[model samples]
Target: MTAELNARLEPTGERWTLVFIRELRKPPEEVWGALTDPGRLERWAPFTAERDLGTTGDTTLTMIDGDESTPLPATVRRAEPPHLLEYTWGDDLLRWELEPSGAGTLLTLRHTLPGEDGLGPMVASGWHLCLDVMERLLDGEDVRAVRGEEAKEHGWEDLRDRYAKMFAG
Candidate 1:
């Protein structure tokens, strides 16, 4: 756990940035697989991801609104399997950096928003939910559906609070 999980906000010219870091009791390759593999991503994320992962070329990741079946375009900037993944959403940059930590892996997520306006909160919640789903999936838990509603209703601050309580032992 880190300060990023507290919903700490960083000022970025016009936009705001949110960061989240977690240490998993799993290998970097396993974490990387869940993130870069479409089959694994669909097991955790709300939308079914379709991408040409494990390749050098850039790919598009869409966050499909399951209810509406609409796709939100997400651009993949860089994908280095088992190491890093960077994607762009609107004016935000979503990055995942993985490193081996002791016997597990340390995952750091940096989500930068373009402005401190409406997009900030939405992005925060979205990232929070995604992270939550990732956490569960990594633990071999079943989290098939998109839990966006939790983020939508609670907002960023509430998301942190809920995660703290839900995951706290």
Candidate 2:
């Protein structure tokens, strides 16, 4: 939870959107692999994609929330391996952009929600912890995915409050 908040919000009509950025100490290819591969995703992401997200096609992702699982019908609208990938999980769009930065990879995640429900802080905090878990997994550290209700054990509430203040001021 001590990690700096790296999320910014923009109002688009009646919808709310946020961009979460993370710098990983790995190449784009490696980072991309983590993003598209199902196994790698399970190691960090809160949801699990049924197939490799590196391809442009239809796929299903299951969002894990405690003991409940929500099946989200998704489609990969754009897929440029090792660089950019855009997909839809249900009605939400998730666009990922990766760029090489001094032997590392700069990851940018653009997530758009349905409405301006003041949920930016909650979403940003979730992504923050997920990205942190991803970074550690990329570094060969054995860490499980920290997400959903379980994220509270990993300081999600604190992150949410911190992000709320950040977005407010």
What is residue 75's positional error in candidate 2, in angstroms?
0.6
lDDT of 1 at 96: 86
Highest lDDT against the true fold, candidate: 2
lDDT of 2 by residue, 52-116 (tens): 99999998999998888899999999999899999999988899999999999989999998877
lDDT of 1 by residue, 116-146 (tens): 5445445555666676667778879877645
lDDT for every model?
0.66, 0.90
Q: Which window of 10 residues has the lowest lDDT sum in candidate 2?
A: 1-10
The lDDT, on a scale of 0 to 1, for candidate 2 is 0.90
Model 1, residue 159: distance off in Å is 2.1
